[model samples]
Target chain A: MPLSEFDIIARYFAQATPGRDDVVLGIGDDAAVIDPPAGQQLAVVIDTLVAGVHFPLETDPYDIGWKALAVNLSDLAAMGAEPAWLTLALTLEQSDEQWLAGFSRGLSELAGQYGLQLVGGDTTRGSLTVTVQVAGYLPPGQALTRQGAAPGEEIWVSGTLGDAALGLRLVQGGLEAGDSAAEQLCGRLNRPQPRLSLGIALRGMASSCIDISDGLLADLGHVCAAADCGAALQYADLPLSSAARDLIAADSGLGDLPLIGGDDYELCFTAPADRHTDIQVLAGQLDCPLTRIGRIEVEPGIRCLEQDGSPRSVTGQGYRHFNESS
Target chain B: MPLSEFDIIARYFAQATPGRDDVVLGIGDDAAVIDPPAGQQLAVVIDTLVAGVHFPLETDPYDIGWKALAVNLSDLAAMGAEPAWLTLALTLEQSDEQWLAGFSRGLSELAGQYGLQLVGGDTTRGSLTVTVQVAGYLPPGQALTRQGAAPGEEIWVSGTLGDAALGLRLVQGGLEAGDSAAEQLCGRLNRPQPRLSLGIALRGMASSCIDISDGLLADLGHVCAAADCGAALQYADLPLSSAARDLIAADSGLGDLPLIGGDDYELCFTAPADRHTDIQVLAGQLDCPLTRIGRIEVEPGIRCLEQDGSPRSVTGQGYRHFNESS
Candidate 1:
């Protein structure tokens, strides 16, 4: 017997309710009901991942599901909000029970980890696409935004960058890596950890923040635009994973990928220079490195400089979703 | 210059946000910030419409945009909530400036009418697909749910049924109609009016309620399942538009189309028989017709009755998103 839409939702998507006190009504209704905490504003965002666009069509269903929710969580992390609820809209060409099982596992696992309740969503038949809208809450006036950076503030980035971009290259056969290193690179490309804890920790410390989804420069540009300032970065100071460093050593051409590679899912933030020790303590407490690689400048455009006080020449632009070649 | 994602959003999706006091922050951010009113719970839902699946691929982009948000409003109305914020995730195969302009106009018109603030969303490159997630607010304990119907309550529906289904048939050339009637029917199909006002009127009075997207019988089945009761409907009592009645009068076989046809976008509810006069007054106040077509029964399955007390059999099931033959 063919699985109906209802059957698909019940069998795979109807996860065990996490006993959320705020979710008054969850799945199985026309809409979910949530009683948000007092004095906390809701932060919401929606993102769509289409096959052959966000990820390779041949990517594992589990990885696709993980990445879909992970990216949305990253947005919430950027805003310094604790994830409270999420809704998924999944479009599939056909029903594959095994694929559904794997996908559901990946989604449920991440949702469980963060205490996010999968409150409501839709399942439809079409070309494969996954759209996730997440809701998080932060105390009124406490939520971080990309519009608060001031001149002379230090810019910090959580976690190493560019591993995911390299992972994509390795998986697509555009680049090659050794065995264990290949596993780590491909995993980075397939599964990114949202810096929720880091975001929460930097709530009052960081003046402005954003997630690195469209590479470092592009996302940081958003911060600059919102904050009405410019940024200057020491290109050599960008934190890089050993895997990415080795890849760049073998091919100097790959050195610029971290600057323009997308899907990093790490928080790029600006904080006062006096709070440098506080950020260092946060990094130690969370076991996540927070590196200061730049500073907000008075100018109007982003500038990349070498260690020797010389400008570095970069090639290509950041990822644009609408560009025909993307 | 190729349109960047940010450029597309600013030009098309960054609508003049309705002055919603609850929307602390709206478009152009990583996520939107909203503060639901105190003493109210949030009703949230997400829906997706794919090209050639939910609607014809040739349908106008304007109509597609309107219908995408309209259908989500229908869900919110069914919950007796007032819409507050919405986020859209649109994926397209390519960027067409003309199409985007028309779509944004249609979206802005409807959003402006309902005071729905377009908070934040994402636009990506892929096969045409539109996903909208809406958030509304209702009193914490006054939500009209599908589980509140009593066994002896009267079942009611709002507006006319089956017109959109007939419209689909006419448009697809499966059925024929006059030009004026065709235009009327097609308008009903493409531009469904979500019964927001009537839904608010029915809040305290309605025992159970749902929007009729998947035909009367199919949607009523959901009510029955949730209420733990059966339903008995007099087939001849279903409110039908003049165009639909005339079409059915020509061919008796087409009579069942209204019974199981989908995309009505009308409300189906159950209330006490004593509230009949109250509902009548509500219909007058809201300027929407209320038709009492059936009653909740103690049995386990839905039954259809002819005027002469004979059993009527439905020919086909309502539209299911995943049904291969639908």
Candidate 2:
């Protein structure tokens, strides 16, 4: 006989993570009770991943679970919140034990790394979809929001961008496989790091921050619109991995991908020009690469410039769900 | 051109609920930041409603939105928590403006009634699905959990049962509609009144409690399993609305539905036998009906007894997702 939904949850997900003291109740009840630390505000975010829409249908269940939580945590990181708890709503076509085990393991591993406890959720039979909501804590009045950017602030991004998009192409068979580069890009697509520590350290330094999930240009456009300002990107200074550089060199048409491709999960932020030394020191201390890619301007549109400081035309507005083409 | 995801959210869902002082930041950001009331524990719950699975494909978009949040709020009610905030993740087949309008109105109306603020969420394109996660607060050490029932405690339930199941049947064309009773039952199905006030009042009074989403027998079975006890329900004492009784009289087999059917969204709880008068007064004060239908027992299984104390056979263990018949 097939295991019942309750049985599946109990066997695979009930004990997926060790209990935390702040969790007054965890799983198996109508709701989970948590105690948030005093004097700190709570930051909450939700993201959903649908099979074939968010990831390839053939993607491993483990990667699906990992990315589901990873994406939500990245949102928290963008807000400079320390993740505390998460709840998952998983809709599966069937109660396959093997799939449940793999998904649970993947979800639990990342949750444990971030000190997050699986509090409460529902599991039902349907097409494969994963919705994760994470709650994190931030000190009072210290949230890093997009509206804080000011004109003339230096725009910065942590880690390399466009790797996840390259990985997506590799997965879609647009790029050849069987190379270390392909494997590395696929890893970035499947498990993009959240950059939580960098976000926390940049809280007081960066004027504003946002995680790059919907391509750098489009996401930067959000910061510009929020702050009522414009931005000028030094396209030459945009960080790229060696593999990405090699692929782009072979095919210059792929150059636009670093600007228009989505799913990077890297932080794009703006800071005052005088904070350059402080940011560099903080980056060294955190051991995360930080690159200045642009500067906020008084004008109100996003512009990418070449090495000679001339305007470069960029098409497309990142990934939009209801657009003709994502 | 269709509306993009961000446009849809801003037009339909961005101002769905009024701002609250506790919410430092709301929509259009990386995440929502909230200030939870000090010294209160937070109760979190998530539930998903898949079109054609949780509700009929032809169900009203308004009803779908109302029920999605109602069901999750019902879970919090069972925990004796006062709802504070919610996040929604909606998956849709297309950007249907009419559907979005109706759905947003339904959700916003209920949220306003409960003082719930829509904090943050995601909108994605996929099969029609709605996942709602609610966070409520409870006074310290006063949560009504299912594991607190003891032998000799009297079991109680709020409102009536089986109406929603009959509503489902009516919706499915299994029963004739077009009558006032049918409309009332269907209303119960479409918009369940979460016993939030009653649950808050029962915080320190009820020994154990659970919302009746999976029928009376099945949910009671959960309380029994959690408390390591059994239950004896008096069939005669089970409360029924006049409409349900009239229909059951015309079809005798329908009598069992009050026990086995699901989606009642009422609260079934246990309290000390000595607190019967206090409970009665509470019901009167809250203007809600409360019926004492059974008692916790030392035996290891659930049993139902007729008016003359003779054992009445009952089968089926409420609703179970992934079950062969469910």
RMSD of each: 1.3, 1.1
Off by over 4 Å in 2: none
Give the per-residue lDDT of model 2 (tens digit) for A49-145. Answer: 9998999998888898899999999998999999999999999898888888889988999998988899888998888999999999999989999
What is candidate 1's lDDT per residue for B1-326, written digit by digit as tens? 56778878888887644768998989977889998898889999899988888899888888988899999999989999988889999998878888888888877778888999999999998889999999999988877787888899999999998999999988788899999889989999998989888877888999999998888888889999987889999998999999999999998888987778888999999999999999999999888999999999999789999999899988887778666553
lDDT tens string, model 2, B1-326? 78899988999988998778788888889999999999999999999999989999998999988999999999999999999999999999999999999999988989999989898899998999999999999988888898999999999999998999999999998987559999999999999989999999998899999999999999999999998999999998989988898888899778888998899999999999999999999999999999999999999788899999999887766878887654
Model 2's CAPRI class is medium
| Candidate 2 chain A weakest lDDT stretch, 10 residues | A317-326
TM-score of each: 0.98, 0.99
Interface RMSD of each: 1.7, 1.6
DockQ of candidate 2 is 0.76
Write down the TM-score for model 2. Answer: 0.99
Per-prediction DockQ comes to 0.72, 0.76
Candidate 1, position B297, lDDT: 97
lDDT of 1 at A203: 87
Candidate 1 at residue B158, lDDT?
A: 95
